[model samples]
Target chain A: MATGSFATSGADLELVGIQKRFPGFTAIEHLDLVIPAGSFFALLGPSGCGKTTTLRLVAGLEDPTRGSILIGGEDVTHRKPFQRPVNTVFQSYALFPHMTVLENVAFGLRRRKMAKPLELAQEALELVELEHLASRKPTQLSGGQQQRVALARAVVNRPALLLLDEPLGALDLKLRRQMQLELKSIQEEVGLTFLHVTHDQEEAMTMADTVAVMNKGRIEQLGAPEDLYELPHTAFVANFLGQSNLFTGPVLEATSHAIAVEVAGTRVLVPKARARKHSGEVTVGIRPEKLRLLTEAPPTTAGVNTLGPGTVTDVSFSGVSTQYQVDVPGADSVTVFAQNLDFGPVVTPGTEVWVSWKVDHGFGLEDSASEEAKFAPELDTATIAVQAKRDLAAELEVS
Target chain B: MAFAAFATGTAKEQAPRRKSRIALLLLLPGILYMMLFFLVPLVSLVMTSLQAPVEFGDIGEYETAFRWENYVVAISTYGEHILRSFGYALMATIFALLFSYPLAYFIGVKARPWPLLQKLMLVMVIAPFFISFLLRTLAWKSLLSDEGFLVSSLKALSLMAPDAHFTGTGAAVVFGLTYNFIPFMTLPLYANLERLDTRLVEAGGDLYARPATTFFKVTVPLSMPGIVSGVLLTFIPAAGDYINASPQFLGGPSTAMIGNVIESNFLVTNNYPAAASLSIILMAVILVMVVVYIKRSGTEDLL
Candidate 1:
């Protein structure tokens, strides 16, 4: 694991210690975020994880119970939504049913007391490629077209920050993809900071320059999409962002450069930064794509510290990749995803194989004292029992 | 083979036979009722309005010669009453709308606990219905009388003298009409305004529109269907209502509406032809007003 120094910079809008509490629940808790200007930022999380609440706080639709929201280094926490230089494209699009498309886009300009509202509205409609449908009502347009109308309505105001709350949630899958690219390009062309809230991980990873993964009313991690994917700081991020095969172990030795640990009765070495000091136990994390399977045991390569003999328990072909679940010694199953690049012949189920990966591929975590921690003592026992049962059943079937 | 073919053909034609019988059965009772009640009565009313009087209390009076002059006399005699009825109806509609709009908007849009407010409003609307129409009108009369509680309150406030009178005047009649019909106006407006998509309002506010601008641009225009219905309900009933403007109530000859004239001509004066003619003309005027209103408001679908 390669570690980088923590530094906050290039943020135009900063949310400092933001907190919001509803009657019986705290929707957000001490949320600190810095959104860089001219960046497409996404607040990605599960449902009811305060993603929408954060967006609403920034939009001034809801006030924070204890925090300040600063836009471009000026405090805007007390300002009304209309008073702030920000606009929102609501999830439902919320186009006025009583007005034509042109009028809907022109509404903000008219309210701002602009001299040439019609001309501005026409230009906006043209930008969204909705000029021909200007005379039609919102109900007359398709879902995608209505989404464009909403985008046009928000962009016409020329605000410094544009907020979008699941604007493409109503579209079909193909249309959603198209609109995602369009939204990204539009944000680039306008050179405005966009704060988008969505629960779709792929949507966030595809469009946003930076993704903030939130869980349980807190930001779990915030970084570039690729960095977050390659290096997740927690087990939650590892599982949430993509798939990971985790291993439990106890650290035997530690240094500034590397740490040695025993995982599933086998000695393994991992980077020092990945090892957190704890009483006895730690968790080892490895991406499935990094593991390799070989039919015969090979000599250990430099920096490759862990190898184990296992039987292929399950083999599933997923088009571009093939996933293998290997049942290793001490009753642990590790998954490995191998690219299907005509790699000789595929391994069959119940085949004996050796799985190995580099030391840097595995990151260690401190054994958590919390009850709700993912790697509990009972989970290890359960895995051992299930693996023993499966091995016995397979032996009997083979006999 | 020929007999089997004929049997198949007959089975295919059996569905139409059952359908034809059902269609005839459905039409039979309605046709009989229309002929016996509606068509016969309409033809007799037209014929009776045309007949001249032969002898008083004679059954054959309607068989006399057709007298077209009766319509002319009816109009010349009761024209003022017809005009007063229309004027009162219009005034009542305007007043009801003025009072009900804000109340409906507030209750429908601004009220947080909407179910409770809706139940309360429903109770208020049906409260008058629980009392007899005449009893409600009489109650209004008592409230507007010279020595009524309202007049006394005004006198106590030094806004009026102790002897301020409201009975037997056009204002009292209009007030009675408005009070009776206000709920009719409110319910539809509340229904429509409550069903209004609040997102549209929020969208307007997000676009930097003030509350007032949103009300006019989105709220009012979307609620036109309700407004038109309320106007129709209040205006039509208030115009045709003689009970509220009768002499037994807070009304006089100056406050007598077209319904009063129709009632007196038919019951008191025993002038059936003139009464029928006046009724026809009043119906025509109301029909024309409804047509004009529907076309102007572009809410003909609501009708």
Candidate 2:
């Protein structure tokens, strides 16, 4: 693992039954996750979903109320943040404003009494393509430059697990996309475990090998990004990952290969492997892009699930694709994303349309009603959001 | 039509000029106040410093003559007291900083969550200001006197010699100065520390710095502006303070500072020129010292 001069592989990070509780609410509850050595892992969630708390717990910035954390099989649950072999690229970059870029990057190495701190810091800066800015103070740099400096600062330490708490959340859109790719390549080159926490789903999907979608202090689903997006286990994951056309209904028949679910008087078949619940009431869901908006009724194909006789309520043309919101009978709304192939007629609002998708594309959630109820009110209140982002108030409560 | 166009162009050009004139007019009160209270007194003091004693006149009489030798005489005659004032002020500034940094840090950073406690602490620091400055110095004088409980306790504890007393010592005066001007030291430090970003300290700990290293490397460097301003606020006023260094207060004849010397010259001996010369010397020395200190501290942007 340590063959080259600056090459040090990561250690396995294990969180065993971790739980974090604030004064009035639980931030994380019963989280047991393991990222294999040298893998890029991401904890994906909305605000206040305990992703940041999980990162802090692993970084030793916050202690779990009822669990242990182990890195490479050694317990670090009670260790100070500095004692453990972990570093964080904080959300705000938190670069020492008084220090030059070189000094800030060299801080950890110097503190650890490491050899050739300046040279190593320069190397890290070069990795981020910021060697020319080594002498500038953090405040002097642009947001993108400061972000790279923060990355260099954390990566230079070569810690066992580098925790990134929304490290690129402050960047503009173009810079954010560029940093995402650069962060992925750097993680691969360093071969260290990068535990990234972010609320941006696209960022998480693009940068991580395994993404865990968290909701209300629990992992809603954990899998490869494609798997999580394709077959979500919970309604929260299905909605959060991307727009979903969901239909809540009771299972009409449970067969070996698939389950027939009745949604608004129409039957839809979800693959048995994709159905989180097979014999009871379930919520069937499909990605917006997976459904097709048909001007006429779809053919009575053997393997297609269709919901029709709806009016197109809204149509949005987004350069590469066209999104249609269809108000179907007995169904609130069904969204469909059609590629701008330019071969079909332009469908305007108030046009009759049918939303259809292949049966195998449907995924079913077991606990549909309660999860949907919890997701709706989260967006309306301001207090809930403030409470969610107040995870850094540990010291205030502890004292 | 051409004449009308020319008149409009001139009016347009005069608009900004008239606005600037209004700006100057708005500044008239402040400028007049400075001239009346500051510039006039400064000019009068300079004139008095150069005045020579009138021949065969009263003790307070002097005639206008450029006696530059007054400065030379002030320095040569009262050099010890001048040095003693600065020395005591320097010690008091250091003591105030040492005492207030922790208190300010605790109030600004540690007690941040309990806002009520922070406010209470600030109130306690400024509580001395409610009473008159002279009263506070007089109170300290009595507290440190030979028969006072504090001196008696120290004597009984063997921390002080049995024959020793505190009423007239240099330490007593410095203590009085530090105690009196502590709020000056604390308020600026607290203001700066209050605006400090605590995430930087957390970053220090995340980067392998222990608590003490984090404090020295991060917190202290970040609080330099506060420290510099606090030092200035305490040192400048404390250097010229007389009540704490007077025989009527905490100090005695041997512990006389430049302020006590100036007081005696002005009121007792009626030496107006000498007192004015000494005041000018004190101001010049403080200005030079402050400039050098600010330059060395590298917080010139604060000014």
For each candidate, what's the DockQ?
A: 0.36, 0.42
Per candidate, the number of residue pairs that clash is: 0, 0
RMSD of 2: 7.6
lDDT values of the candidates?
0.80, 0.87
Could you tell me how far off, in angstroms, the CA of residue A348 lies in candidate 1 after the best superposition? Answer: 2.3
Instruction: Give the Å shift of residue B15 in candidate 2.
Output: 16
Per-residue lDDT of candidate 1, residues A107-222 (tens digit): 88888877688788899888778899999999999988999899989988777788999888777888787778877777787678889898777788999999998877899889
List native contact recovery per candidate, as a fraction of 1.
0.72, 0.82
lDDT string, candidate 2, A208-322, tens digits: 9999988889998899999999988877787778767788888899889999988879988989988888887888899999988888987889889989889999988888888
Residue-level lDDT tens digits of model 2 in B160-255: 999998989899899999999899999989998998899999899898899999999999999888898899989999999998989899998899
Q: State the lDDT at B37 in candidate 1.
A: 100
Please state every model's RMSD to the true fold in angstroms: 10.0, 7.6
Top model number, DockQ: 2
